[model samples]
Target: MSLCEIVRLEGYIQSSYLAVYPDKIMLLDGCCRADVPMVLDYIKTTLKRPVTDLKVVVVTHMHPDHAGGAHKFREETGCLIVSADKKKQWYSGIGGRTMHFVDIHLGYYVARRQGRPLKNLYYSASL
Candidate 1:
């Protein structure tokens, strides 16, 4: 069996894992929206692979630190998004939208605490 290399990428507010195989790549956790460029750069420049090689992105949860970059990745690379099958989005309705906003701010707070510059972490609540 072939082995895959797992690389940990430091995100804006958290870390994400990238599973690299010869033909494809999978990202564990979407990471913050601000981290999209960094992740893509790593795949293209560091890994020396085409961005389209990113085949899957698993969003473990609907938080800014976990699912923020999912849609952007899909849009940029045409990658598939994998997540829990749920009837409704985790962030739904007025209250859920409020919480989504709060969560993004919370991510910013964490970045500030880590001495990182604030970045745009806003993502659509529904995904």
Candidate 2:
């Protein structure tokens, strides 16, 4: 798998793109709740590299930073985004589901499990 970092637009969010194969790619985190183009530029460049073809965008859960770029990426790259089911509904503009948020403790736990320091914890919802 290959990973790429795409910084979000100022006052926006951050994102990461993962390419599992030359013909497949999944977006780990998205730029923000709305549209953010800088992140898009990052991914496009990465795909253009004669390396990998980004085909899918997957998010770990809901939240703008992780879920925001799904639609745009799909439109731009013709990539399909697979997100946590609950989040998928939200992005479809048919919002009527229970909204739950992530906690810092769980975040810390995840970081620890990854052998990362808790204080250095950061997340891109698109994991």
Candidate 3:
């Protein structure tokens, strides 16, 4: 039996999870880019592991609060970045890129019009 340890990282307005499995580490919601240091420190100190040990960084969506640190995490950890779902079109090539851009920008525009910050809005689960 494998024990999975899940840690909820603090300080970020958006909640993020670090799930440590026996053989793999999966980060759910990369948090803001500004939270990178805190997240990395938590993984190293609390988990007693190096950043490179992370196997996957799953970004639930392209929202800044959820995926802002994904690029940095990938660059730093050399981990594979995967989407939360198996929908190929939703995360695959040109179409995926276009969709992400459209969704994020449209979300921002709507939030702005409503006098709310996008970061304060909770993104729906991809699944």
lDDT of each: 0.92, 0.48, 0.69
Angstrom error of the Cα, residue 76, model 3: value is: 0.8
Error of 2 at 23 (Å): 3.4
TM-score of predicted structure 3: 0.64
| Model 2 CA deviation exceeding 4 Å by range | 1-11, 33-36, 50-52, 86-127
lDDT of 1 at 78: 100
Over 4 Å off, model 1: none
lDDT of 1: 0.92
User: What digit string (tens of lDDT, one per residue) describes model 2 on residues 35-112?
Assistant: 335545544673463212556677665565566556666666676667555534442432322232333344445445
RMSD of candidates 1 onward, in order: 1.0, 9.3, 6.1
TM-scores for all candidates: the values are 0.96, 0.47, 0.64
| Each model's backbone clash number | 0, 3, 0
Tens-place lDDT per residue, model 3, 33-86, is 656778888778988888887878887766656776777778888888887556
Instruction: State the lDDT at 123 in candidate 2.
Output: 29
Which of 1 and 3 is ahead in TM-score?
1
